[model samples]
Target: MCGIVGAVAQRNITPILIEGLLRLEYRGYDSAGVAVLAEGNGIQRVRAVGKVIELQNALQATPATGHLGIAHTRWATHGKPAEHNAHPHMSGKLAIVHNGIIENHSPLRKKLIELGYQFTSETDTEVVAHLIAHYYSESHDLLDAFRTALGELHGAYALALMHEDQPETLYCARMGSPLVIGQGSDEHYIGSDPLALLQVTDRFRYLEEGDHARLTINTCEIWDRDNLSVDRPLTRYEHAAHSLEKGEYRHYMLKEIFEQPQAIRDTLAGIVGDDHVLTAILGPDAETRLVDIANIHIVACGTSYHAGLVARYWIEDQAGIPCTVEVASEYRYRTVVVPDNTLLITISQSGETADTLAALRFAKDQGYLATLAICNVAGSSLVREADWRLLTHAGPEIGVASTKAFTTQLVALLWLTTALAQVRGKPADQIAANVKALKDLPAIIEQALTLEPRITTLAERFANKHHALFLGRGTHYPIAMEGALKLKEISYIHAEAYAAGELKHGPLALVDEDMPVVSVAPSDALLEKLKSNLEEVRARGGQLITFACETIDQTNDSNHEIINLPFVEGCISPILYTIPLQLLSYHVALVKGTDVDKPRNLAKSVTVE
Candidate 1:
């Protein structure tokens, strides 16, 4: 994952570029850099190996002012995280910042080296700059040189390039990665995501794949892959700046964990009413298609993949449709049969996940009945490409470890499950009861947040542990996986999740006093079996921290700890149960003094393979 921002303004844009990089920090980056086309200095570039603050300080020591500039925050892929490998790489006449991998960079680098192009960095991006510069030497036209260089390259990229000769212009292009142009009065902005431009302007144009653009103070011109100029629709994005702020919370992760109640409420608003469940977002033929679907294929990666696993249980049990969940990266490489009348569903928070997008495109090439995306971003690539789209409305999740996004995804899946059940001629009373339960989820989530103080205390017991195991049964198994993922992501603990029934198969052997077993125990049909599983953990001398419903009588045991959770109806229990685990991870990370928002070696958005 990486971030790129470019600007062309009538006034100095160094401050804007730096601020944009600061906002893009949440995307996760190892190095920061900026290149500016100054009046007399030509293209002045500065880079730092650590944080954006380092880059800011570097710029202060050797200041550069310009009206046209580009900046980047890189999460290293092709090279080590160092000043030499940082972005805005220069090649005599051109400076470029890129946000994706070039698959053929090795061959191209070899060719360029043979042609007497000297390399200074171990990055695939450096080749692009040199290639463009080589083309410009012959063509003498910036756009044509860029176009020819792009034609010769292979792989995913979102590039921002500036030429020393053309100090007032910025050229940008995107293939697989995300890029957008923010329109402002007498100024124009380009960024990998809208967060970079939220403080500057809300009116922006999202570039489609294989699109290139030239930005100037007075004009913004977009060109298609075929070298024809294209008009991209400008949308007025209404995301408030305050939504990205931490407010009173110490970190965005904690604020997001507490924001789950409102996030789920916004996700379910108008879709679930007291008397009916709206299926209109699935398109006009949702009713007939839902009932006729033969199989359901859910594809996602990371936390979104765990959410899909949870939805598989709900879809099969409630809608009577056979469901299969697959990790997107693995699913794309394998030859899988896509049966007719099968619905393919994708889940993502940013909707820009590269693997998931590739899997969705692979499914599209096959003969699936329809495509549906349950995502947070409204106009993201996943939403725009799918036949049906449902926005989670979780707002901006800034933390590298997801909390609100995963819960809101479960909310959307639960709604989809009920909609399918209703279309399948399930009893009206049953559907209405589920809809009523859905309406009360916000209150239930609020009740769950009340347990945070107690969970924070419980987290002290886990803060020093080297490893942990999470256990759950039936539908809650996926919730266990997500809880384990959250704990390991933020706290740096080696955590693993096992279905309660699968513990004896292998994972139970790792249980000991040093390894705590955290169990997500809801009062469902599998409660008795889950209790039995907990007893096995207790017998193995594994310290226990169980999240159980209040009515469960397991608290009387003196050997184990029990954190009471709010009792909720039906499949909504998983969504409610996720809050305490999130708090546990946050508090544990806080206790360990780790970076709760930007975890090491992880990025919020995985835009590259």
Candidate 2:
């Protein structure tokens, strides 16, 4: 998860590059750097170990102004977060910024070392700069050298390179990672995201896998993986800058949390029609695909994986089709026994998650019925490559800790469940009833948002908590997992989630007076079973914090605290309960004085493995 921004223009690109880097701050980074073709000279670069402001301050002190440049905000991989490992790594006249990992860098670094190349940083990216520079030494053509260098590299990458000799041109390439070219009058740009280049250009072109381009101020020359020149479509893209602003909220996390009501409404708007679920929103082949579906193989990472886990319960309970959910990172390594007519589903907010995208590719050949990408970004590699795509309208999830994306995904999955159930012989009225329930979800979640003040007070107790245990039953188990993930991600608490039944087997041992045990007590079939597990935590003298339904008769005692939420029907309970957990994490992070929007050691869109 790194960011890349490049520009080839006749004007001062310094301010533009710095602002682009600032726009990419949401993606998360430990080190930042910029490489520019110096004013009437060779290449110049500035790198900083901390925030982008440090790089900005460094630039203000000693500017590297040029018309052609590439900037990067790196989320460390292959090396620690340090100025030495920062991007804009150089080799003589060539300066390069890269996002994604180079798997064969170890061997490449060794080979380059023997060829009279001296390494300065312990980064795999430095090898790319040296490799390109090595080839440039022989060919004297920068594009030819870049293509040759790309051919030698293994694994995913989105690279932007600049040559001192080619002052007016910017070289960029994408292989299993996202890269976009911005079209402008007498100027062009390349960025990992369209949002970063919005100030300069409205029209953008997305590069597919193995596509490379040479960009001049007025021209964008492209080539496919076969060294064939190709032209990618240029389409106008527009986003209001104020839409990204936090406004009244202190952090993007808080903004997105409140945005969930509208976000879910938007996600369902395309699919939920008058008393019926619109199956066509999924794709032309969705109904036909569901007809033969005997199983589902859901693969994703992080919060998306947890979303899949929740969908597993829905698919089985509603459609009567067995579903298995696995973390995308581990799915490819194991020998997967895919059943006949098994549908492979991959979920991601950005749709550019490296492991999930790679797993989707691997699953394509494993004899699945079809692959569907439930993604947010329409231009993401996963959406472009998948057989069928369901776009989640979460807008832009700028916060590293996802809120709206997760709920919007749940909404998408619920609609998908209805579509699947329809073809699988579920009652039409029952399906319609479930879809009808979704229409009220926005209001229900809005009511849940009203419980934030209670959550804020509950979160104060967690400011001193270093460890937390989250427990849930049935579909809520995944909700528990997601809540734990949020708490750990933002609040920096050591949080773990276990199925309520599994608590006594091992986790109950960790429960004590100092330990906080949190649970979402939904009024479902498992409520009685979940209460027994809660008793186990209470027996262990743990601090019990329950986000229970208003219908449940509960009182706060010395050892326990209960925040009653607006009761909802069983079908949409998970979505409703999720809000309080999010608020809990946010308020807890605020109390702990932690960075709520941009968390440490994490990136919003995990674009690399």
Candidate 3:
């Protein structure tokens, strides 16, 4: 995903746009560009490969000024990262900056070529600009021309356009990617990220699918697909004001990690109380039906999948239901035998994730008895499709790494387990005690974040390792997989996760003293079995970093170090155990001097297939 922003301001817009680009750079860093409509002049454009600083320096070399403008920090899906491929792609009269892929770009390019439009760069975005220019020649107005061209386009996109013919206004539209309109004094802005508008304004309207906005210096008009003008409500963003400040922390990642305490407290407030956990959606037969189900099929993408993995153990042990977890993409392609009375649970931070949403639709089509979704967004598509829903009060998770959302999902899933146990007629004392544990999770998580120093130190040991393995069993297996994914994505480390029991099958052959193995060996029933597995690694001379519930006194046999974790009940251990692993991967990436937040070639949302 790339970042796109546009501003029509009473004052000079270059600085505002540039500042906005800086905030949105986490979305992409391949290249940066800006196009502004100059007074009594045509569109002035500047672009360069690399970060915003490079574009800033390029702009300094040859400056462009205008009050109405659009800018993009590109992630380069369609072409290489070069000046020619950089965004703010321009035609004779139109300039366009786009995010998301145009899947039919080849056919669109061919049609435009046949229509006598010359293309300058190898980009799907360039095709859009040319298409607009082609139509503007006929319509004589930018907005009407834009509507005509967009009618032919396909795939996910959030586009912002500035035209020489319509220099006073910037037009924006969204299909799947995030776009927000910020209201300002004598100005109006559209940005892919809310952080771009944080300094300029607090009030913002989140543009929905098929919505378009025309922004002028003093006015903004939003329009739907049918050409009817509409007004979307604006909400005051909570993090808008405090966003720019590093405040009491050194980096946003660390600040967000520490903010988990407050995040948990905020998420748990009102949702759980008086020794009873609650879901945003609850029914009398809901818990009983879920527990009575023959099987569960949990589907999600990225960090949400990790949460599902944790839930698998809870559902299996506590609710006595068989559970299977799948990556939504693969799940969609596979021929799934939907067992009758199966509950298909789809989890997503943003319920609009292309693959996850498709998976939910597929599950419904196959006639699964009940489909439930755990998500953060209120009216997201998955919520509409599911028979039941649980909302994690994680607010908006702006960062791509997904800190707060993952924790809140864990809270919700753990609550689901307790509720299922209760409805299945579990003893009162057991249900009450488990509810008490769930209530105390926020405090326990706060205590966990204090392990920052320990995690940081552990990170140093593995920072230089080229290859690694994350091993776990049962609930911890998915956590191991998540940790490996994070390590590989952020640190550029070659890592794989495997169940500890499955290690000897093939993965163990790659292990040696030079390679590090991070083990998730919590104090569960399989702890002794996991201990013997760790011994196998030691016998093979593999360096070890073990995360366990208790301290290991015998640390001499190829064991590197042990990070003690909070000992909780087996049902809820995955939630608490995940904290250290997340911190460990985060710190390792930090120590390796990698871009922990944006990680190369990764976007916060997968809007396009």
lDDT of 2 by residue, 1-609 (tens): 478999989888988898898887765567899988886767888999988899999998878988999999986655677889998999998899987667678899999999999999988899999999999999998888999999998766889999888889899998756789998889999998887998888899989778999999898899999999898998887344338787777888998999898777656643554455655444434567678889999999999999999999999999999999999999988899999999899999998898999999999889998889998876678886887777676878899999999999999999888888887778878887897789889998988899888888888898788999999999999999999999999999999999999986899889999999999998888888888889888987999999998888779999989888877777789988899999999999999999888899999888888
lDDT of 1 by residue, 1-609 (tens): 478999999898999999999987755567999988898888889999988999999999999789999999986666778999999899996899997667678899999999999999989899999999998999898899999999987766889999878877889998756789999999999998787988889999988878999988889999999999999999998554346778778999988888887777657643554455766435445667777788999999999999999999999898899899999999999999988799999999999999999999998888999999989886578987987777787878999999999999998998898988988888898888787887788888888888888877878887678898999888888989999999899999989998999989999899888898889988888899889988998998889889999889876465599888877785788888888888888998888889999999999999999
Candidate 3 per-residue lDDT, tens place, 1-609, comes to 367888998788899899999976544256899988889778888999988999999999989888989999975555667899998998887788987656568899999999998887888889998988888888787788889988887766789988776778889998746689999988899988777878799889988778988888788889987878898998998763246455666555566666666555544443343454432224334545655667789999999998898888887777677889899999999899988888889999888999999999988788788988888775578876787767675655655787778878888888777777766767777777777787667677777788888788878887668999999998889888888887887788899999999988998899898899998877877888888998888889888988888644444343667777777766667777778877887899888998777788888877777
Regions of model 1 farther than 4 Å from truth:
1-242, 556-558
| Candidate 2 positional error at 20, Å | 23
Q: What TM-score does candidate 1 get on C-alpha atoms? A: 0.62
Which pairs, if any, clash in model 2?
Answer: none
lDDT of model number 2? 0.86
Q: How much lDDT does each candidate structure score?
A: 0.86, 0.86, 0.79
What's the residue-level lDDT of 605 in candidate 2? 85
Could you tell which candidate, 1 or 3, scores higher by TM-score?
1
